[model samples]
Target chain A: MRTYLDCYPCFLNQALRAARIATDDEAKIKRVLDEVGMMLKEIPLDSTPPESGRLIYRKISEITENIDPYRKIKKESTEKALSLYPYLKSRVVASNDRLLMAIRIAIAGNVIDFGANWGFDWDTEVADTLEKEFALFDYDKFREKLDTAQKIVYLGDNAGECVFDKILIEEMKKPVVYVVRGAPIINDATRADAVQAGIDKVATIVSSGTDAPGTILDTCSTEFKALFHNSDFIISKGQGNYEALSHTSASRLIFFLLKVKCRVLARNIGVEEGGIVIQAGRDR
Target chain B: MRTYLDCYPCFLNQALRAARIATDDEAKIKRVLDEVGMMLKEIPLDSTPPESGRLIYRKISEITENIDPYRKIKKESTEKALSLYPYLKSRVVASNDRLLMAIRIAIAGNVIDFGANWGFDWDTEVADTLEKEFALFDYDKFREKLDTAQKIVYLGDNAGECVFDKILIEEMKKPVVYVVRGAPIINDATRADAVQAGIDKVATIVSSGTDAPGTILDTCSTEFKALFHNSDFIISKGQGNYEALSHTSASRLIFFLLKVKCRVLARNIGVEEGGIVIQAGRDR
Candidate 1:
């Protein structure tokens, strides 16, 4: 992804602010400013935007000086998701068919995400539509299916979404493993963050092995492969996971995410912008 | 400065490597590995030592990520001086002294920073010594025989070493107007560093309205001030300029820069380390 010229000033502003905090001397400040000015003059700004929504999303994350604003928004989004817990719970209880029950469990698992407006939301909306599309879904069957699952892997997204994932895990009434993206990028949930959020108590949190949203089979470790092979269902969150794994032959991998506008995705899914998209492996 | 444990993995290695062009996949590799296992948990058996010395310095300047590293270093250091070309040249040559003829005019305007090291080769041994014992000097000869007829305003240091004022600017051989601390907290340059640097070009670069390095004398414009005032010489740089006149000074101000060990400055200086200084000024 290329950074545009418009963002160059922001970088300068951040750098200057950092310099100010570092020193309070007139000579030091002047020197630093001069160097910065020269740097600005030298580096050519990239005008091109990224090809993938994931790249754009990551760039936005990198460009922000303080993570507080994003954290606050993520918290709000989590609260919204938590508030919908009753609806999610009721939907699970009302589902009758085993497939519908599995889908609901996958959807609930999908709550873990980086938490932003993008194509993943569209996937959730699709999950929501599935309840209306099928008549066999009932709450008891969903509960029964969740209870019997051998293992469940919940992929986490952004910071606040981890909070929501925690809530969802508690409501699952089944043994589940929470998966974090590991070190793919800055500010993503780590084992430390998961522990800080008290997620360690409810589910075993593991690394997905790649920063991209999709499951790149080759990148997976022996432990991850074992877990994937043994799990009854895989719930992947966000566009990154989808991009990496959507074309794979993995049968149980279910992607839930909102759609950000991207030409490739729009063409593939026959949708102009990202929204809820849920594809059972056979559909692809 | 002591780096934190958390900073070691990213800052010492990955981030540092990314600053050089040798490995484009540094961040990507870290990200991929991080996804599979916690970054901290997957410590490498053989970690490579950072490339040090002048070559590392030169290469770092060419890469973008090195900017942050330089900023970090700047934050850790004390005092910085920026010396860009034209402004420094004009200030030195303005006196029209015969000794000024020896200076390399082509490179005369090239920036020469003191203190903080940049990713380039520059001497620091002299600057470091001056930073420590700056207060033990008496300038009775320069002070008693000073001429106010020149209307030169000598710039003073608000913080750190005032050595440059004594050594460099004093060599210009002009009767300098010295400015001292007025309401400020500590010692500021009163023609000290200029004397030390053997500068004879300064008529005066000092405080009239305020002890602040770049304080603007707002009471009179060019018309009223020029009648009473002689040809004004403004030679000031560093933090004082940033604080007092970066925004509002009316006089033609010369600014010198040096990359310092400060995050804020490193970011502003737009370099990975220190040494490089810039000089710029407003044309009156």
Candidate 2:
């Protein structure tokens, strides 16, 4: 979706949050706010939020000299999710509709996001996800697409969320290329993070060739873009990826699995904020 | 309290809100954001939020050519509060402690703030405020000061809130100079607003001689400053006044009556967000 005015303040808030995590130096943090404030003026509202998000995270990294501010947090998140893996698996195995259960678990794990700035309890989120109704469930469409597709490009979101994605991928029982970010931005999963989550064991892991929190096609490598277009079935995860790819004329190949995190995305998807969705991507 | 880093993003958000209220011209609204974004860079952390707030509203006015963007809204708020005035007085009359009930009513009206961006219902807020415990209740201190004080300076806040302040001023039963903003900023009360709220009928309504949302001493006229210094008992209403005067070495004369609306102010005041306070200001 296109950048809204609401996104401007949200961008600055995210910049400050990332900057704080990156460094303790008050001066550097203030510099981040000052520079980011100045930077916001030049940003056009027509561009996708992730297009500007790419610049914001890069700016935070540059000012703080901390390339991966969320490195420690991401590691802890992965470990925490891994510890819950056996239990998560048991739930999926117990469910009559294993694929649907796994999808809910994956969306639940999405609450781990730092960029969304939601203060969520992990246990509560998992329990709530199991019971909470989806705002937009395109399950029949997802099943229909999966039935005909040969290969699936499953885009990964956060580090911990990857473990939940693993359950869904296992249920898919298809040749899946698990797509991660090219580099660290916020808590977005990189190839190393995906591997840490044991995604390598379940599916082939590859970078989307963009370090941005989302897969901005212009920032992606040619090979990754080729794979993205060639794949008949694609799964876009989280608000960032949804934002980056939502405006694309990608037909109906991509199904977005995410919890609506912000007002802009919620309005765009015709869902309330904090509602979960499995939306089918279509031509603009 | 000094301006926190959190205030930067909040300022932008408020700017956007005020801009939208001011005009439908998308270009002008965008201009407000761009200019406010640039302006934020120049603001000093030591300066009060309303010091910068002055410049932000000015920029909006200049960009949109709407000097009093909230003029119509202020009128409606005043009318709404006026409608509630008889009921408010009845509550005060029925109470065993009339002054205390009036104080609660005054604080309840503070929920009328647009700048705080709290989506509050008037009836619910009024009911809640009557029962909500104060985070910092300096009622004993306030009463003691009121017993001896011959003259008072009551710093008024927003338009609808002025009607509530009128009740409190009437309960004071002493000579009161009801201070208001010299010109409009946000929904903050101006001389005209105070008059419309019948503040002149109860107390002598005077302009603080600053158009800023709050009473910044540097921005205040010499007369207002002199009156402020001379008054033995001062009642500062709402967050903006508290924000502006909180840093001053004003002894113990200034009693700040406000609902803690934002995180930064809440943190500074040692209260939780949404708590009410009758805070006694002291020399730093």
Candidate 3:
């Protein structure tokens, strides 16, 4: 979707979050925020919010001189998720409707985002997302699409969340290509991160070859775009992917599995913030 | 308190609130936000958040060409409070401790602010705030200060909250000067709003001779500043007044009767947002 006015402040908030993670220096944080301010002032109203997001994170990396500031945090986050994986897998395994349980776990993992600038306790949020009723559940549609699909592409979001995605990929009976970021950007899973999270064991892993913190089609490599075009079904994860791909006119069957983290995105989708959504992508 | 990193988003949030009030035009709204972005970039790190606030509202007025975007809302808010006045007065009269009830009532009225960008069911918020125990109640000090004071200057915040201030003024035995803004700025009370709220009937009413949406002493008239200086005690109402006057090192004893609104301000005061406070002002 085109950038709404609400996205403007969120851009700054995201910048602040990255700057904070990048350094503890007050002057540096202020300097980065000031730079964010100037960029926000000139951003075109029609551009996608993540397009500007790409700029803000680039600036944060430049000013802090730590291209992958979240590297340590991402490792810690992955370790934390791995520690909980056994219990999570047991819950999914125990459920009579295992496919449905896997979907819920995958969507719950979407909450691992740092780029969204939300602080959440993982266990509570996961339990809440799993137990709470969906605000937009396209379960029957998802099942139907999964039944007929020849090839599937799964988009990955955050570092820790990539591990969680493995459980859902294990449930899928199709050949799955799990797409990760080309490079590090605000805790989004890169090739190194996805491998560390062990996503390589569950699905065919490939890089999107862009560091926009989301799947911006124009920036993706030819190989990734060709895979996207050839895939019969796509599973886009988290709000970043949602923001980037929601406006695409591509007729490929798609499902957006995410927890609504931002108010603007939630409002755009006509749901309250913090609601779980299993939404079918645009068909046109 | 100095502007926090968090205030960057809030600045855009506040700008949105003002632009929405000013007009329905999307282009106009975007223009003001873009302007707020530029202003946020240059705002001093050492200054209070409200210092930049003054610039934002000014830009809103200049771009929208509506001097008082909150004019109709302020009138409606005043009417809403006036409708509840008799019942609220009865509550105060029947209470065992009249001053405490009145103080609660006044702080509750602060929820009526348009500058804070929160939509409220004022009746419910006022009722809730009145019934709820204060997070920071300095009752003994407040009572003792009131008992000892002779000349009193009461600084007002929002237009709707002015009526609630009258209730508190009625409880006080000391002569009071209810100081309002000299002109319109957001939903802040001016002489006209004070008169509309029947504040003139309860106490001496005067303007601060400036519309900064808070008490900026240097920007006020010579007469208001002298009254402010000479007064034995001061009762400052709402977050704007708290923000503008909190840093003052004046010798006059001051009581900040406000609902802590912004996270930045709440952090500065070491309180949670939405808590009612009867804070003692700075002496250093």
Top TM-score prediction, candidate number: 2
Model 3: fnat (fraction of native contacts): 0.65
Question: By descending DockQ, how would the candidates be arranged?
Answer: 2, 3, 1
Please state the CAPRI-style docking class of candidate 3.
medium
Q: Could you tell me the fnat of model 2? A: 0.59
Model 1 alpha-carbon miss at residue A204, Å: 2.0
- Candidate 3, residues A1-284: lDDT per residue as tens digits? 67888888778878888899899998889889888888886788787777788889999999988899999999999999999899889989899999999999998888898876578888888888889899998999999989998878999999999888999998987888999999888899998888888988878899999889889988899999998987778999988888888878762457999998988888878899988999998855
lDDT of 3 at B227: 84
Model 3 iRMSD vs. native:
1.0
DockQ, candidate 2, vs. native dimer = 0.71
Candidate 1 lDDT tens digits, A171-260: 665677887754534234556556656678889889866543345556566787788777766555444455555555663344343333
Q: Write the per-residue lDDT of candidate 3 for residues B76-109, one digit (tens) a residue.
A: 9899889989988999999999989989898888
- Which candidate tops lDDT? 2
Candidate 1 off by > 4 Å = A1-149, A163-173, A184-188, A192-201, A230-232, A251-263, A271-274, A282-284, B1-284
Q: Judge candidate 1 at residue A203 and give its lDDT.
A: 91
DockQ of each: 0.01, 0.71, 0.66
Q: What number of clashing residue pairs does each candidate have, in the order they appear? A: 118, 0, 0
Candidate 2: residue pairs that collide: none
